[model samples]
Target: MADPKGFMTTPREEWPRRPVEERVRDWDEVYVPGALLPIISKQADRCMDCGVPFCHDACPLGNLIPEWNDLVSREDWRAASDRLHATNNFPEFTGRLCPAPCEAGCVLAINQPAVTIKNVECAIADRAWAEGFASPRPPERLSGRTVAVIGSGPTGLAAAQQLTRAGHTVAVYERDDRLGGLMRYGIPEFKMEKRHLERRLGQMRAEGTKFRTSVAVGRDLRAAELRARYDAVVIATGATAWRELSVPGRELDGIHQAMEYLPLSNRVCEGDLAESPMSAAGKHVVIVGGGDTGADCLGTALRERAASVTQLDIYAQPGAERDEDIEPWPTYPKIYRLSAAHEEARDLETAPSADADARLFAASTLRFTGDGSGHVRSLHLVEVDQARLPVPGTGRTLPADLVLLALGFSGPDREDGLIDQLGVATEPRGTISRDAGFATNVPGVFAAGDAARGQSLIVWAIAEGRAVAAAVDHYLTGSSRLPCPISPHDRPMTV
Candidate 1:
């Protein structure tokens, strides 16, 4: 146990963020650098280390939350990092990007605020890198087997690293010019800096994981050719076929998908462009979805000096407290929580609309009216009930020079012909079909992450990656030593 009465003695204190005025002008992460190190130990102490920690069940990666929490509270960072890495392949990525469902299932969260698990995890990962506790662990002997992993996102990276460390010659192929996939382009620097990604990639390279960027597998090399070359192929290409909002005037200029807009901003941060061609500067932006992606668009638009921003959610606003009848404890409930982007929107008054948080809940887009030049001028919408049925006489229009659809993704993109050429079966939901062992219909071919599981949290992606690696290793050899943290049927704790 971290402390017998630590939960009673300490209240949850999160890592502080930089002032809005300062962080908005720059692309650096929102949190104050080096801030968590001082307070993280105390925060970790708040963990009860319960006899039956539900946090383990909530996390897709099955992270050893209690062990790491205890290690962090004792200031045993190396041990903490080891325990964290025992289950998770990339705590840094999940520590920053994951929504921390584990905290929602924390036993303490039944009444008190959950122990700062995410912050403690992030602190441990950052400190591990700083103290040289993280290093390459190359295989002692080559297995003489080769594996080709498609996609360079979190899933592919995790799978490749595990396979490489298991003595297989692993190669990861990415369609983008650079590695990290969405982490390189989709995610803004304000959320997580790329330096952390680069550091991990460096470690993977030293561990004998090969990377092939700017190579679309199905196009550059046929699936058959790849199958013949490598002993096994793991498809970790994430769900990228973004969902569309089909309505009147859908083709108007200045209306784009959130993925389309977010990546350009990331390119600007990467020095690939002086400015984003789809910059939201001086425009009234209307985001059509009120999820993390919408918030991401909101933050990027604000940094670009958008005249105003408003995010619309189809679902009604949730209450501040959990509705136990609807979503029970130990399950991830849909509650009203303020994200950094929403906080910025609220503080800056950038989004002037029905909701104070720069969000219009129960709102649905009707159509976009275009200016004479074919550019979007305004957006029409209607407030609705929980069933998404429009409320009568609730129609309204808002100035919308730019419209972004953050409605989420449907499935993996088929543009590269990976699925078509590979003869892999797909589910009705557009996700790749995988067996209990993460194997696709085709032999020697496996699938994982968003490609198989559909769009999900980064934690799930890494977990699927690790599990698929073990399956592939078992198929190649009669037995395997790799840890399979999760099964293909496992899902996050959600209502």
Candidate 2:
């Protein structure tokens, strides 16, 4: 550590964000650029570098948190980046997108605030890129074996990069027109700029990973044909089937799913579309769901200049502090959080303007009331009990020109044709079923990430990718050397 008593001397300081009024008008990232460089080192010093490092146990990727924290505190950014990337294929992505369970598991967090592991991590990665420490790592020798990875999300990309560096020919397939799967389209630019993704894709290309976009495996080519062409196959196709609200007026014109609304806004930001078909401009928007996706919709709708916004959740409002009985030390807690969007909403509510954002908890949607033209006019809701069952005599109607269903996903889209043709077994949850090695019932084929594990964090997806690559490598060759972070039988302690 840089200072033995640093924790006592300095309190935790996070990166500063742009003022709410200023950031709400554009799609740029909310955090102020270069704001963390000054404070992150001091924050890194707060790490105790515990004897057992429970932070590692908290992370599904098993990131070397303490080592990098020490390295950052010492101002050895180059070394810190190396340590950070040793296990993770894309620290930049995880650094921005991950919820940072490692911080929750920090030994210091048992008493005081957790060490700023996530901030230090993002700082180290940004410094590495600025100093040119991050570059392609090509293999020394070529192996005769070849592998096909389906999907361009974090899992597929990580698997392809690892296999390429292992001297095996690797080709990644994506159904979308571009690589980066959800990273490229589902995520908005305000959360993470696209430049970070582009630079990583460049490095992967330099490292001998081939990408094939817009060529779906089970649709354009038969699964049998793909199996015959490649020595082994790894499927990292993420879960894309959005869960629907089966209430009355589900087919109303202004009612749409979160996936449908989010991607359109993202594409508009990328200049691919002149305008989003589901634009929330000059409308009263109500988003149903209390998850990150709902928050994303809240932000995007605000940016689109919605007249008013309201978010509803079936669950009761979480406590401000962690509940000791439900979530113990070194485990992720269930507590109320104020995301950037929510912060903006609070600021707007206190403004002089008449329009303000609203949020309702323990609420359930009864149905939609539409005008004669089939356009949504209002939403019918009722107060819900602890189990989200509707309570009597609490029914109300609120005007709503647009309604976004952010209820999250069910599983992978079976319409992909690959699931049907391959005849792979699926669990009751609708995700592909795999054995301990991540291999499906069909031989020489493997599945990973959301496609196999259901919807989850990017870190878990990457871990699944690396682990599945090892299993596939072992299947193709008698022995393997790829690092397997987690097996199919292993579930995250925090989960």
Candidate 3:
């Protein structure tokens, strides 16, 4: 509403990324700082403030997108931050990491480029921090109820913050030495700096949310014992078990899982190590799998100055444009995307002989070949059909010194004694089984996030946390006032 003809007058312009050559040399964020501020307000003004905002429905958090967009456009950053924080607990995290399905569902996106909702949201949150508008709000009265929240990921952190503000004594337990779960370790620092997480943790601490790191539940104490110690227990331990490749030569010395390689790089950034144990320097690197994780590996390997880099995907390359019938507007599209990492890879592929990258679509890995030193030397590959099945006549070999398996995660770590002690039912797919209310078969216990829902986005994790907190509060007090953002059975608009 800031400008009635804003959508017509201005076209969408995205935030600028740092130049490929300059950014890949270090672990800095890909986006150029201060580059989006000039155009962000204008881009935000594109929101029509429609009568029925489908973008709300598209978001798992049900973020007040239009309201905040208008507020940002008008330069009312305080009000915009309030509106953005009303639903989402971590705008900075989602702004940096989320794929922004809300933009896909923008009404204008049916024809024109969608409003810059994500950029506006990040700007509002950042301005709030700078202006001191964001502060902890502790409850005036204590309810004297104590709760134990297992996990320190987005879901557990959101639930812990909400419950603590609701006058409950909440403690968040993390198995890792530091808080932020995968956000702290699994995610590369180039995608999002760890200081953002530290600042939020500071605010949560000020709000009276207690944190217990390096003390895993069901190991330090039994699940039943934990329930006895607290009035209620909320499980948000995320899926940690990586989906593995069972092809031949899986035990080669230079072969590693994406999780193994990613965490080591993150540790190096943390100054915990001088270098990554799985460094790709001077090695011919081949990454299998073409998901976001694979792209992440590609970027990291290129930064390490690999001799050469090649990425293989079993599926055919996705179309550049969205498929209208199968994926309509107001829902996340199935179009191909060029992530920052992919952009760098493409640049490298077209660069001079000194800087060359390679990508192979519809390629399947058959096995690995190792040298006498027990280190990976090459990969056995085959050209895959449209169905992703290997074709016998199209086999070939590619020289490789380091092979990274970038397949996604499977489920929560069952080895963590928690699952064994609780005896919670699990789906055939390995995810924890929960009812519509996010309640497990056991009474007075509830589950949320990747632990229950499988691998998903931070936005979905926060939504599940909000929903699970409401159900737990209702069970505890016979009524609840917390907003249940999403149901356990509700899949994302993208799904």
- Superposed on all Cα atoms, the candidates' RMSDs to the truth, in angstroms, are 0.8, 2.0, 2.1
RMSD versus native structure for model 3: 2.1
Looking at candidate 3, the ten consecutive residues that score lowest on lDDT are 350-359
**What is the C-alpha local distance difference test score of each model?**
0.92, 0.87, 0.87
The superposed Cα distance between candidate 3 and the true structure at residue 408, in angstroms, equals 1.1
The digit string of per-residue lDDT tens for model 2 on 1-495 reads 678887778788888889999999999989998788988988998988789999999898889998998899999999999999988988888888888888888888887888888888889888989999998999998888999999999999999988898888999989988889889888888888989999999998999999999988888778788888888888888999999899989898999988889889988988999989899999988899988888889889889988878888888788877777888877789777888888887777621221224578888899998999999989999989987788999898877899999998878887869887888899999999999999999888899999999998898999998888888888877879999999876776753
TM-score list, all predictions: 0.99, 0.97, 0.96
Tens-digit lDDT track of model 3 for 1-495: 899999999988998999999999999889999887788899988999999998999899999998999998899988988999999889999998888989898899888888988888888888889999889888898888888999999999999988888888999999988899989888888899999999999999999999999988888777888888888889999999888889899899998888889888888888999998799998988989888788888888888888778888787776877788778777788666888877887887722221124567778899998989999999998888887788879887888899998888888887768987987888888888899988888787889999999999888999988888888888777888999999988886753
What does candidate 1's lDDT look like per residue over 423-475, in tens digits?
99999999999999999999999999999999989888998999999999999
Better of 1 and 3 by lDDT: 1
**Candidate 2, after superposition: displacement of residue 346 in Å?**
1.6
The weakest ten consecutive residues by lDDT in model 2 span 349-358
Segments in model 3 whose C-alpha atoms lie over 4 Å from true places: 350-358
